[model samples]
Target: IDGFGGLRSKTKVITGVSLPASIESIKARLPVWNFDGSSTGQAPGEDSEVILKPQAVFRDPFRGGSNVLVMADCYTPGGEAIPTNTRAGAAALFAQKPEEESASGPRRPSHRAPRRSST
Candidate 1:
């Protein structure tokens, strides 16, 4: 969210990168990129700059094979996580329930309890 709490997002494609690397490696190779926040309603029009910090990586289910989907949080230039950085909250939530965490992070159980049949 921006100073106004409006949700915003953008799609960025990165190419010319080597493949078959671990997600952590990809994250390490990534850099903090910036964008015009005003264009995304994330900052004032005059000095609107929002910083993106990569936090996690997932296999790009859409494109398939060695592709990735990077998860990131927004932050100010000075390093303060913006309200849009909801992963911080999720981390805290998982901290309180470690067993709830899975390889893909916290998720609801896939199993369902059996219902009793009415006679």
Candidate 2:
């Protein structure tokens, strides 16, 4: 998800190293990447380069094997978390709270409350 807790995505082509490599090693070898955030409503066109840092890895169920999906945190070129970097804040809160105590999910305003079913 993008920093704003919205579901936005961009795919990066993997090269050189393949699976069997730890996520940390892969992240260590990769340089911080930037993308134009204007399209995502994250930044203005003139200064839209948002930097990404890999934070976690998930198995790529689509590709399977050692292939993985990366979870990243976004930041400005100045090294500050983007204003919408809710992941960082969530991480901090998660760190302080036990796993079971934490509630997580995208909270879209357009989603309606759960409906009660009649027996």
Instruction: List TM-scores for all candidates, in order.
Output: 0.65, 0.66
Candidate 2 per-residue lDDT over residues 8-62, each given as its tens digit? 6667877776755455566666567788888887878899999988876667899
Model 1 C-alpha lDDT per residue in residues 45-70, reported as the tens digit of each score: 88677789888777789988767877
lDDT of 2: 0.75
Q: Looking at candidate 1, what is the lDDT of residue 8?
A: 59
Error of 1 at 64 (Å): 1.4
Candidate 2: count the clashes: 0
CA lDDT, candidate 2, residue 50 = 93
Worst 10 residues of 2 by lDDT: 100-109
